[model samples]
Target: MATDDLNKPLGLPRERKAHRTPLVALVAPPLLIAIGLIAFFAFGDGPDDPGNVVAAIDDTSPDQTGSVGPALTPVYEAQSEPLVEVKPTGGLREVRGNDVIISDPSKPRPIRLAAAPFEDLIEADENGLLPRIGDDGTRPLDAYARPAGATEGMKRIAIVVGGIGIEGEAGQSAIASLPGEVTLGIVPYGEDLPATVAEARALGHEILLQLPMEPYNYPDIDPGPNTLTVAGGTAKNLDRLRWLLAQTTTYVGVMNYMGARFTGDDRALAPILGDIADRGLLFLDDGSSARSRVGAFASDSAPVIRADLVLDGDTAPAAIDARIKQLVAIARERGYAVATATAFPSTIARISAFARVAEENGIALVPVSSLVRADGS
Candidate 1:
């Protein structure tokens, strides 16, 4: 493991979603004409639509893409500002004064991406929600995987911009702002998580579900509701996990959200990681904890990638830019590097700039899936 010396001045932090339309009822005069339609143009085939919305459960699995090539130490974000509401985007957790992250407390609106879900991989439950395991292959993690196209000797770096699907506009901005090679880790709590995922896939970005996990602080510093808790036991935790997994498809794997406590116990987490593997998905440790045991458990079984840096722990333009440079340096030294960051505007903007400049610096900006261990994960 690379020491924190790679970059320490600014870094580590944790994890949002975003979109909706207004509903306007039309009541004309003349015998009280009834013309009330939800003006909120709900896009095609969303979760709320009549048919079960399966993002990408194709019956025929996509052909196997080529393999893993390579590749953090940063702080999770600790924003102290008061929460505020953003119009259209709704309520948000403000950061960097003007920057915002999508916040989800109550049930969210069913977000639908402009693109259609890949149908072959779908298997609908009684509720018409496609969250169960599919027969054969066709898992979204495989069907929608972005090809790495790694060269023989190029220094590769994989970057995961998480906290997606939280704040409406920020999430969209992130999808548009960064290149598709940057893997997006979407939180399942978002009302439009599946939709955000659709947009991500449309743009050729690999996706990962940011599974909520118990931080050591427990209820004090919660990752979010329905988080897989240590007390939840394997049965309960797996049940909640399946629900989360059903929220979206067309991604490569699963990532952690403040899982310091949940990942500490070897026996406690083994079944969870094992299940993720069984689902034909990979596991990514965001590296929030230097002492996390995910590395050990995943080593023998799952296809996993751990973070080398938390890009926005400092949450400032200069600090974030500096972290990018540090990330580039690590990639050059190790042949590959992976870093995780929240969707703060500063982080997104800085990473965007770095992606443009990375190739010029002799570094290849690769997807998170590309960084999985070489054993054909």
Candidate 2:
């Protein structure tokens, strides 16, 4: 009786044999379902998905069918507007109301002029037409000098670029490129004196007659024809000066070319300066002569201003730039500074670059005439 009962558990009645599910049977359905889902996502393109959508096209159009269009073609229409007249201001484009101000990098604002050869300012002498004070007490310094605009609180820098008209190309380059506030020192012996001067004046540069005077080495180093000399008496030097003044019209003053010996001698210099004062012209000392007696005569004679620096003494670009920095420092310290330079190509290039940015640095480039002090202060 008990032989069958050995395989069964000892339970109250004969327990029904329990059935166990196989692991594969339990997991196979879900595993198969996940594989199916991944395959569907990877390979199936759903109808409602934008990524699988295809654009419809009308293949019936002439352009798509390779047929030519008609002879009449559509044209684009745009409104045409007239150009406005722009006024030139230094290096900035400014807009005011409906007007536009454009900057001309090449053409600087011109200094105002009173027109050349005021009849009252000229007198016939043995040399030529000499500049003189008008019968109504007007001086050439006032008549021909470029009027200084409102400088106010800014530091003032006056630059005189000399040797213009001496070399044709260099002179033209200087005139064409330099700012209007720069004064030009025209040599007495340059060709086309009147025409060159007129061109420079038209561009707003104040003019100065560069008087050739004897240097320390006198005859060994001549200053060219009609040079004023310490040996030349006041009468003789005055004659030579008149010749120089006669070479050009509309100059505000005279600047010495090479006058170490001539300017150091007060006896020889005073009378010449006195004559310049009598003619109503200013006198500029180029500052080359350390022993110059110009200050001694300035109180009694022509208004005098000495150059604070010679910009192109070295003629290198770096040297010129360094000198310009020094010049600004001087101006900042004294409220005004004057510098003289030859019309060298390097000098003109550096000055042109400097002029474009001078105002922003609080430096006002004024005409040399503006800095001339009668008492030589």
RMSD of every prediction: 22.6, 25.2
User: TM-score of model 2 relative to the true fold?
Assistant: 0.70
Q: Compose the digit string of candidate 2's lDDT tens values, residues 1-377.
A: 68757545567566577877699986897899999989867655343433332211112111211121221222222223222223223212343343322333443233435336899999988777889999998888878877667798999999999999887788888887787788999998887888888878866788999999889888899989999998888888888888888887888889999989888898999888888899999999987778888877765346888999899999899999999999999999999999999999999999988988888999998999888742342
Best by TM-score: 2
Which runs in model 2 stand beyond 4 Å of their true positions?
A: 1-109, 112-115, 373-377
| Candidate 1 residue-wise lDDT at 344 | 81
Stretch of 10 with least lDDT, candidate 2 = 57-66
| Candidate 1 C-alpha lDDT tens digits along 227-265 | 988899889997788777777766668999998988887
Q: Where does candidate 1 have its weakest 10-residue lDDT segment?
A: 64-73
